[model samples]
Target: MESKSKKQKMSALEQLKKFTVVVADTGDFEAMKLYKPTDATTNPSLMLSAAKLERYHYLIKEAVEHANKVATTTDEKITEAVDLLSVLFGREILNIVPGRVSTEIDARLSFDVDKSVKKALKIINLYEERGINKDRILIKLAATWEGIQAAKILEQKHNVHCNLTLMFSMVQAVACAEAGVTLISPFVGRILDWHVANTKASYDSTNDPGVISVSNIYNYYKKFNYNTVVMGASFRNIGEVKALAGCDLLTISPSLLEELENDTETITQKLNESEAKQTNIDKINIDESTFRWMLNEDAMATEKLSEGIRKFAADMVKLEVVVEDFIQILGK
Candidate 1:
């Protein structure tokens, strides 16, 4: 039995877990086990890194073999292989975590609602065929106008939940909630990096642009009674994590998870739905044009969204190359 004072020395990670659903933002199974995250998120970039790990090397090989049987051309094989790899990673991560695993659609489909919807459904079907129900998976899409529209369709028609990623602006959050998307993962570290690079100014946890962005969106969602889950993601440091301690969810990297485990700082709940409801906030929704204009007005959000999409797409391309190279080797 442990004494009260001894248990009081709980690490910041444990403390934060008390307030928010701690999510492992990595594709590494060991990391998810290390932190015991409730949920997990993976994008092309994370998946690309994970697919290359020696421990998980078999996944890409498996994908390559399956693709080789079904695909006729290098381009077709690469696409099929990557898609299968995404679901493979999702399945493995789901087995490790008790909650949902987010599997993203290719970022190249970010602008086409129909293609995004089709690709998302294909991923979900792949998971379902593996005996994993749609309930335990989130079809992650970019938070573009088209992506949000596709999410709405998935949520309403197919009963498949969606996780809107690359979210940066309040307008994006607002639009996502209005679309009845299951969740939105706002990029916290990327926002902070943008501010730091351009402004050449320092930021503490309290006034960190990333922290403030998530907080504002959290409060707004609570105020308006939106059911969309606000997940703060892509964290740079533990301070940013500590500041959004009470967010609905936060996807944190393994490196920062280690930092939280070592620090025994007191974690406080900063944002509460009850408090937000009592605060003054206007009911708001963003139309397509308004959404575009508002997003354009916010330079940080605009730049980050485009850059994020490009990065994800580039990773997808790189993953394709790996698959193609592996396929060529097998042909020898």
Candidate 2:
């Protein structure tokens, strides 16, 4: 007999298709298979956590072995290991997801325009050599001004798509859209995290600053008809996900995806262009200096942006160590 759970699950997928593109923001293949999200996103931090798991230990070992063969220096070995680990994860995710999988560049390259672009192209080239088409991958980069410029060049010259990460402000969003990047991941949970830490104030979804930030960006994008896709990322809870139901896309963590799957409740659309066009928002362009200055002025954005980069970079280093240890164990 058909189960009630099956019926409800079908209904949820039907409903989800109406409003947003659901993305699985995880490195766990088991979870992603169950959720059946359109795309998958991963960062060094998530990859590091996944590496510690027994199920994913093979990735570490494989990366280490691959690194040992070609690396002439310690730094080269580390970078090679990271790239291998990222590609392994990306390949696994691509097997499950029908759409793109975002593989992030090293966060340490966030502020270095040339290095970030070079690394991004390298990741794409690695994937292509493995028979993965460039269309199936989006190179993720920190949405610093430098990163945006790099994305611009990548888009124009190499025909590579980009997923701009760590975006915090309207300025950043506008800049990305203007640059002709493919996608933008505006962090919802991280913004809330900053607000809570800075103000010592509690916030509900309706009034949450993070919620407002995403909504504003969505509205702006829809208003101007930018081709860049807005994928709301780093959600804290199911509430944030439900609140932004009509966003172009939302990259949700495994726990939150589980929560949404378990609940049989309804999700309503909260954002659309008609409503966005009704608002009176003044649009402005910012140069590099002004963009940085504006970012610095927003205490929450300034702090969280720096903190996010450091956290991702530290995790990348830890992941490098794990890969190195695995290589040593394998006698590679």
Best by lDDT: 1
What does the lDDT read for residue 104 in candidate 2?
Answer: 95
Error of 1 at 211 (Å): 0.7
lDDT of each: 0.92, 0.86
Q: Which ten residues in a row have the lowest lDDT in candidate 1?
A: 1-10
TM-score of each: 0.96, 0.94
For every candidate, C-alpha RMSD to the true structure in Å: 2.0, 2.2
Report the C-alpha lDDT of model 1 over 1-332, residue by residue, as the tens digit: 45666667989999999999999999999999888999999999998898777899788888888898999998888888889999999999988999999999999999999999999989988888899999999999999999999999999999999999999999999999999999999999999999999999999998899999899899999988889989999999999999998899999999999999988878899878898788787877579999999999999999999999999999988888877888888768
Off by over 4 Å in 2: 1-14
Which residue pairs in candidate 2 collide? none
Task: For model 1, name the residue pairs that clash.
Answer: none
